[model samples]
Target: MEKHSTLAQPDTLASAHRTFATEIAALQALDARLDDSFEQAVAMMLACQGRVVVTGIGKSGHIAKKIAATLASTGTPAFFMHGAEAIHGDLGMLTRQDIVLALSYSGAAHELLTVLSVVRRLGARLIALTGHAQSELARNADLHLDAHVAQEACPLNLAPTASTTAALVLGDALAVACLEARGFSREDFARSHPGGALGRRLLTRVRDVMRQGEALPIVHLDTPVADALVEMSTKGMGMTIVIDDNKQPAGIFTDGDLRRLIARHGDIRPLTVATGMTPGPKTIAPDALAVEAATVMDAGRLNQMLVVDDTGLLLGALHMHDLLAAKVI
Candidate 1:
């Protein structure tokens, strides 16, 4: 285990405040320094027919990896190529159609310089993110993004603190600009991040989560209220879908409807499902997103919704519980 200093609370807080202030100032400076160069970089990325290969060494390498992931998830094809690894066998991954995004605070990492030389020889475009525009890496690049910082957030000003943050933010700006330029949508982003929560919500369809076939609670308008209740119980959806003679959804009978029916008529055995069913209930298409179903249910203050086809034929049923179980809520 590492030993920690028994520092006072106020001193620790003061140190944190100073670090935040310094980093904020650095970001403000970067924001003010944005120019047409940033737009040109975005244009290069948008026009590239191949992937964006981000390369860096040390702390910048970590930032580069994150930037690559952000770009990839946001509809841009990108991957990280470590600077040191590029000088080895990884340079083979680059193609003349691809663009190289190099990060180096000092703009003089030996590994990055070697990769830069290979990138130039292959006729690939280069975008350098560095603190010094006069450095070799920035000077040789087709476009240089000035990620200059007045000082590091570190108290000693020795670590790559503010500089790395600026580079990461600049890379993100480029990725977002490219994404908007390409008209990337939420569906596109979900396709790239299928394992994430947003992907589950955006990609999952009503058919994917709604109870269907035997699991669906369905009945006719003439079905007895008692039998409809049995179907609801068996399906565990707290509701039963009422269909017409043509097999189209007519309405829905839910637990709340049953309660209201009981309140209105003491002798419930005489009532048919049609008497208690809510006609013209809000419905969603089977191919619509599960999140859309959730939105409809929420807006109507309903606990259940019926899924139908384009012709209004009953396809399935969705309960709020189904949305919760599918983690789409």
Candidate 2:
């Protein structure tokens, strides 16, 4: 049988909570430590003529990679390089126009020192995220951000728990601040992340996926319910848009309406679309996002909607299946 620690489950839970509390306090310290230097760092990055190169080792390296990705997606162009690899031939990637962001919990990472020297020689400005403001990396940096924490969340204070969290949050702060400074919009982010769901939401317009031209099931308001049903059946969209003499949307008729009409009178053939159809049906513009169409369908308990122009002229129609096929669902 395996032996267990004397700590009970409640004690373990308490320890976990204390760990979270300690890290939260460390982040609070970092928040209070934000100063003019952070502004200067942002300015330096904004003025860079080329890409930002972020480098770190170990846990800091993981944080650096995420920071680089966030910066790239948000607006600023950046890439991550291992500090040790940077000292190798990767140093050739640096140029006079680039800026270096070096992350180190201890201000004296030996691997980073070699890279920092080359960066200085290359005329690239260096920004240091270090715990000690007076350490060698901080002293050499053109902009030094103090990422110091009072203690590690680790019980023994040996592992880099609280310290790494502070660094990661500080990096996120910088990325978001730069994003706002650049006036980057969702469209810009979508362009960067074209393969993701958010990209689909921002990049897809209603007209791109809506059934238009001959595919739209449209009929005159005076048309018989039988004729409307034929149009709906031919289009296979479960609905037909009823238009007035001016060629503008007057109303709509759907499969549900047909079933309800049968339930009420058992005779839909005698009715005209103008008398049996729903008046003033909900419609959407072609330039709107497909997600907005999904929202309307979900809210109104509808299966499809008519796409109209500003003057209420029918331009297209979209079914729930269309949205599902487009992955907008």
The alpha-carbon lDDT assigned to residue 269 of candidate 1 equals 96
Full-model lDDT, candidate 2: 0.89
Across 1-329, the per-residue lDDT of candidate 2 in tens digits comes to 99989965568888999999999999988898799998988888888889989999999999999999988999998999998888878889888998899999898999898888898788888999999989999999988999999999998998999999998998898889899999999899999998899998888889989999888888897898888889999999998998888898888898887887788878777888777678888899999999999999899998988898897778899999999999877
Worst 10 residues of 2 by lDDT: 7-16
**lDDT on C-alpha atoms for all candidate structures:** 0.91, 0.89
Q: Which segments of candidate 2 are over 4 A away from where they belong?
A: 1-10, 185-199, 219-230, 243-250, 260-275, 295-301, 311-313, 324-329
State candidate 2's TM-score. Answer: 0.82
Residues 208-298, candidate 1: write the lDDT tens digits.
9988889888899999998998998988888888988988888889898999999999789988999999999888899999999998889
Worst 10 residues of 1 by lDDT: 7-16
